[model samples]
Target: MVSVLSPAEVKLPDGSSTDFANLDVAATAPCLDVVAEAVADLLPWYGSVHRGAGALAQRSTREYEQARETLYEHLGCGPGDAVVFTRNTTDALNLLAHVLPPGTTVVTFDVEHHANLLPWRTPVRIGTPRSPGEAVATLDEALRQVSGPVLVAVTAASNVTGELWPVRELAEVAHRHGARIAVDAAQLAPHAPVDMAALGADYVALSGHKVYAPFGAGVLAGRADWLDAAPPYLAGGGATAGVSADFAVRWHDGPARHEAGTPNLIGAVALATACRVLAGADLSAEAHLVARLRAGIARLPHVEELRLFDAAAPRVGIVSFAVLGRDPDELSTELGRDHAIGVRTGLFCAHPLTRRLLREAAGRLDPSAEPPGAAIRASLGIGTSEEHVDRLLAVLSAPLFGE
Candidate 1:
């Protein structure tokens, strides 16, 4: 029996309703259904794929391969393109970093996650773009400085502030300079629609765990040549067609070249299933959730203090802020334990990005240090409800700021 209240009022575990300001869509139920459907095939050991001939194995293989095709179609990729499965976004970026021709310069911003920044092999530097306009100029200057085979790696949106980057503009800049762009769509893909070909990026990488499919599978989809020319990310039986007595070998083509071994058959299938489920959700409704969260946050007197990073930047579903006299860890733990609110805290793996935001606010990373510190990050997912938002803000209002 479905509840009478609108979908937003739907109740979830821990006694919270489904109207969380940050969640774009209610994904828990759908996610549960997806998991249930794939449960029979979920195995502890990696199953044989592509080479499996038995009925169950064949069915699983078909599902896994089909998942890749579905992802390509979902992202609107064209012919001659390919999608190689990886363990997660980290694996995907590492694969690209290694495959990039030697001495290839990579251009990106300082605000990007480590997954985007740490992978580049050549001239690893951060762009200082105080504002959006300055960001473009900064890239323009960097492009001018480098005249070689280049790769522009950037995040579609920031994980900390939920700030969306001008990926299209970045892609245009890269293309104008004869450089290719690869997007780290880990955070953005789960929240918004991401089309690699449409976004003008040479490649896009994302993880299934963040996308409601936490089965340890991810994808690197786009340009076929660079991946084809580069050696496989891993070497095993599946990647090679033949191994001779003299230790000679022949490799497989397309995704098989990079896949290398038995794939996460169930994980791939579930990610595709999750994507399909998300595609069917009302984006307009999701947009409503974002607006609601922003408005609610505005009601708090201290909320304005959190926007110090890029006040005018378009954000997705995250809000990071520093409390006057409270530790971010203490706040996050209390929210989870006392209020049952699940929010991420700390530097969020983008130390430089977090530092940039904190430095401007006169805050310290560790409050007990010589100087008191960093900020608290509240990230929302589709499973988050409105009550979770209200409760969090209410808890924040209870003298935690220490008047």
Candidate 2:
């Protein structure tokens, strides 16, 4: 089991303290105690990476590079692959977008998070499929029509619905039609194991904050050919190998090319530590907790669970829902103010999918004058327990603020 920090106490509106029940792990997870300890241990020796000659500098550089290798192996990447660190998953995907060869057509789904959806310049947007099989078939047909060097961008798991996507099958379909696939694994990596090479993915992006690291770091690991051929993602001192007096410069290849400025040594180390800890975690226990939470939610009458796929479909530790007569925003505020529960209530950065679910629930799309429809999401993680789930359900079932 992964050890996390103790439950934090929050001051309620009545000026009383209560143990905070965090249910917003989908946005950003709490840091692991092991990760925090790892970062604390390295602070004294933290110094310039790959530059200074001091003892601290040498140690820090070695630690930084070792973090890179640790993450590479954790993700099951091949020796030929290159892992480039970025600020977060958004930055990693944006870096990939900037490096695609000219005339390369990109294909993506409308149901994807905005981080994956908005990066490509002109992608052929596929509509949300009713089922995972339909998603694969749709992509197969789309890939057959594209001629040139094609790239397919997909999410390993739905950020809004928590439904798992058929990443391996999607990668196979993309490869059969001479296309490369990139996976946005920010939501998937925290709950389940993600292996880019094993999934046959050409590229994979994930965020550190979502995986119990809580550090501003992410990774884009994939084939080195396209990344090496493309210009440096950022041009600066570290990225360049030699600069001529005549205003000419030669850039370095591998991860350093994209990581131009001073890298986040601490963030990288924390993320790597998190990967190591989670790799050995018994995920079956986490799955059981998620099942218990889902079953409890299903027993509520007025609450309707939001899902693009069937309930039996494999999902991560997330469950989004809407009450029959209450605005999700108001309900979210009450949950935090009256009770000490923290949950996310919004489009969850997947506006297209959220709006579709809202329409399905209300039978009519909100007009332009009305506020945007939203849902309350209770996302679980390693830190979640049975008590947390029970408290949330109890509060939702009872009258809120004496309503």
In terms of TM-score, the best-performing candidate is 2
Model 2: CA > 4 A from native: 363-372, 400-403
lDDT of each: 0.71, 0.88
Per-residue alpha-carbon lDDT of model 2 for 355-380, expressed as tens digits? 88866744422232233388889998
> How would you encode candidate 1's per-residue C-alpha lDDT over 208-277 as one tens digit per residue?
7777776778889888888888887899977897889999878777888888877888778877876776
Pairs in steric clash, model 1: 19-385, 19-386, 20-385, 20-386, 364-372, 364-373, 364-374, 365-373, 365-374
TM-scores, one per candidate:
0.86, 0.95
RMSD over all Cα atoms, model 1: 4.8
List residue ranges in candidate 1 displaced over 4 A: 1-32, 39-47, 295-310, 363-372, 399-403
